[model samples]
Target: MLPVEIKSILEKRAKDGWVPEHEAKEILKIAGVPLPKSAFAATRQQALEKAEEIGFPVAAKVVSVKIVHKSDVGGVEINIKDEKSLEKVWERFEKLEAFEGMVIDAMTPGMELFLGARDDEQFGPVVLLGLGGTAVEIYQDIAIRMAPLEKEDVLSMVRELKGARLITGYRGKPSVNLDALAKAVIAFSRLAMDMAGAFSSIDINPLMATPDGCAAVDARIIL
Candidate 1:
């Protein structure tokens, strides 16, 4: 059963055919996917307040249903360590077309990775794991499996990545907890299955994989 909040979001945006980053993250949160502390701010003052509440060194991105690739359009600002920097970002973001507000999140350091799922016409739901961040397409290192993935299936997907060594701790870096990552993946798969027809696709880029666990740093849902 879809949560009332999620159902309401879907119903409201049904005609838009998409969900903004802030709302999409809410859906992922309900599915038990780990996420960085975040809040949506509709004004500069609110952004500052949320940033301070979440603590300094945060990332802010424009929230708009019309905008898909935020970075490409300069709608993203990261490593904001002070209120001044956040205000600057807010000024720039407000100028962008269709700008709604901003989703501010605490900065999380970890190995960048990707988790995504799409409702395939033939396959039903398909989940993907890969090297993420902005270079996801350039690397093209990904593994895919049908929905409702098991623990073993999720582990295998991780192993299949060409950059698998990175996750296992390469060059003396801390190793990410595969068990915890598997839990996140399984939860995401469940979300895919549960929202099968409710959405067209979902993307969790830069799903930060850390020694302790994983977090979805950014996400998108096409309704």
Candidate 2:
């Protein structure tokens, strides 16, 4: 059964809906996917409060129904170390006509990766994993599998990727928590299966992974 919060979001965005970043985070949260400590703010003061609450060195990005490419529209600012910095970034985001508040997230360092799922008319659900961030398309290093994945299945999917080495302490870089990553992948697959009817596509890019765990940094759902 789907969680009530997720069901509520799906119902609200049922028609001509695209899940916003904050709401997408909530959806992912229901799957028990680890996420950066975050809060949504509708005003500069609120953004400041969230920033302070989340802690210093946070990231803020505008949450707008109209702007799909936040970075392109100058709606994103990172490493905001203090209230003053957040205020400036918030002010800049406010200038955008489509401004609709922002999501304040704690800054976490990790190797960027991707996870996504789409309902295929013929295949039902297909899950995707890949190198994320600016290199997602550039590398095209991805793996695909059917939904309702088992632990072994997700582990195989990870090994199939050329970037698989990254999670195994590639080139002396720190390795991510493989068990945590596996759990997240399993949760995502279940989410894809559960929400197949309400969503056409679900994309989570830059799902940062470190020795501690993996966190879905940004996500979107098309209804």
Each prediction's TM-score versus the true structure: 0.97, 0.96
Once superposed on the true structure, which residue ranges of model 1 sit more than 4 Å away at CA? none
Q: What is the lDDT of residue 193 in candidate 2?
A: 92
Each model's RMSD to truth, in Å?
A: 0.9, 1.2
lDDT of 2 by residue, 127-219 (tens): 998888966888989899999888898789889998789877877787788888889988999999988777898888879988989999888
Candidate 1 residue lDDT tens string, 12-99: 9898888888999999999999999999999889999999999999999998778999999999989999999999999999999888
The numbered model that scores best in lDDT is: 1
The lDDT, on a scale of 0 to 1, for candidate 2 is 0.87
lDDT (Cα atoms) of all candidates against the true structure: 0.92, 0.87
**Clash pairs, model 1 backbone:** none
